[model samples]
Target: MYRLTTHSAIAEIPAEHWNRLADPDTPFLHHAFLDAMERHGCVGESLGWLPHHLALRDGDDRILAVAPAYLKFNSYGEFVFDWSWADAYRRHGRAYYPKLIVASPYTPATGPRILTGATPQRRDIARVLIQGAVQVAEKLGVSSLHWLFTADDETDWLAEQGSMRRLGCQFHWRNPGYGSFDDFLGAFTAAKRKQIKRERRRVAENGIRIRRVRGDAVTESEWAIFHRLYRDTFDKRGGLPTLTLPFFQDIGERMGRNLLLVLAYHDRNIVAAAFNLIGERSLYGRHWGCFQDFHSLHFDACYYQGLEYCIEQGLTRFEPGAQGEHKVSRGFLPTATWSAHWIANADFRQAIARFLDTETRDMQDYLAEMNTHSPYRADALPDRIQAVS
Candidate 1:
């Protein structure tokens, strides 16, 4: 028999046990990453993201599956926006806060929401985990449960359990065994290829030098500089900078090798940086900040540099964070991202279901239209456009 458990903090679970089930393709799912957030106060009741992680274990207390989850009081860091849903609840005189969410806070990358390792009974374990999460929602009397930025397969499982599947789009670059950056660009049309070249050259012409530094190789001073850039950017934009210097320092110490920082230097002074996490077969870009704007520096540090590193390292894909239609014109292709929701109120659930039906159709149309704007030559386009399932 299997039993479900919930912990108020990730530290309640052993890193080895949790990581054994976690996918290496998503560093954000790492126990160390979640633990650091709790340790540094990046997530808590004050930040409106309270850790309420889920774990499934056998009779002997051996963990079979795990999920990074939160009792969300407000939808702040979750990149899958649902502010309208919250407003709808308010309009109906219902509460939406204190909902349960299964996601990596502040991250929008898709991976396993339920981390079930190579167990022969993986499907059964995942089903139990999902049921357990919904049960928790019931016990807490929350409005709903959400599985955000989930893997395609997990979305199917959640939908089978009657969760409303929602489709979204993100721009990503795929590596098709390109020998070099130039080789990768060769797949693009001549005009598009030249456009990319011009952007790269503009950065160089502006005397901005970008260096890809592995996390382990980054000095303490460099981390401080990067943190300042990150925090300042958030401040300037009137957004809360929740991730702290200590949090970055902690992750750098625990999982440094998985980190990649693209630092842009102008006249020997660091001006901008892109924070990325390396995965088994992907490069996941998380954060970027700059003190001063340089010509095409964002493109170089955020997109092109990531693409080049993926090519050089033989990584298969580059997911440079979320939602940028502008990326379509610069070699990144529109790809489907999935999320699933379980609503507690029957009437609201039906309304949401109907809304999702229409939204899904609109999303399909959006993806098809976006595909028409592919930068690659007609014969060389990426063949991985996934329709909403």
Candidate 2:
């Protein structure tokens, strides 16, 4: 028999135990990353991200499966945008603030939601974790339960258990054993390849030098500069910069091997930087900021640098955060992202089910449309798509 338990903090579970079940390819799901958010005050009730992680324990109290979860009071950080659903609930004189979600707070990259090892009973353990999460939602009397940016297989598992599957899309670059950036670009059509080269040249023409630095190699002063850029950018854009400096510092110390910072320099000073997490098989682009805006600098610092790094590092994929169709033209292809929802209210559930069905069709059509505009040469298209898949 297995027992389900919820902890208000990730620290209640040991890091080794938690990470043993996590996919090494997903840095966001690492114990150090999630714990840093909690320890650095990035997530809390005040921030609408209260950590209420779920764990399934065996008879001897050993954790067999785990899911990083939260009781959200608002729809601020989760990228799966459920504001419309929340608004609908509000219009109906119902509450949607305290919804339960299984996700890495403020992260939209797809990975394991129900974490389990390669044991024979992995599937069984995942099922229990899902059911346990639902039971917790019911006991808490929350409006709904959501698993955001979940792995394709886990999303399927959630749907098998009656959760509503929501389809979304992200532009990701896949490395098909390219030896270098130039080699990778060779797959692109001549026009698109020239466009990409022009964009990279713009950064050089502006006297901006870009470099990729590992977390451990980054000095304290450098981190401060990057944090400043991050905050200033968010301020200018009128978005909240929730991840604190301390959080970045802590993660830099604890998970340095998994962290990558892309810095752009002009005049021997730091002007912009992109923060990313490096996984065993993937590189995840997270945040970016620039003190000086140079033409095409954002593309170079964020997307191009990430792509180059992935190619050099032998990483198979690069997920440069979420929702930028322009990335598609830059050799990144549209890939399907998913989320699963379980609404407690029967009426709302049925309504959401219908809405998702329509939305799913729309998403399907959108992905198909996006594919027709692939930047790769006709002869290279087959291999490129297969690599991404």
What is the C-alpha local distance difference test score of candidate 1?
Answer: 0.91
Give the true-structure RMSD of model 1.
1.1
Per-residue C-alpha lDDT of model 2 across residues 1-389, encoded as one tens digit per residue:
88999999999999999999999998899999999999999999789999999989989999999999999999998999989999999999999879999999888898888889768887778988888889999999999999999888888889999899999999888777889999988988999999999999989999999889999999999999999999998899999999999999999999999999999999999999999999999999999998888999999989999988888889998999999989988988889899999999999999999999899899889998888789988887646574323
Clashes of each: 0, 0
Assess each prediction's global lDDT (C-alpha) against the native.
0.91, 0.91
Residue-level lDDT tens digits of model 1 in 1-389: 98999999999999999999988888989999999999998999899998999989999999999999899999998988889999999999999988999999999998889999877887888988998888999999999999999888789889999899999999888886889999888888999899999999999999988899999889999999999999988988999999999999999999998999999999999999999999999999999999999988998899999998998899999999899888988878888999999999999999989999999899989988998898888777656643323
Worst 10 residues of 2 by lDDT: 380-389
Per-residue error (Å), model 1, residue 342: 0.2
The lDDT, on a scale of 0 to 1, for candidate 2 is: 0.91
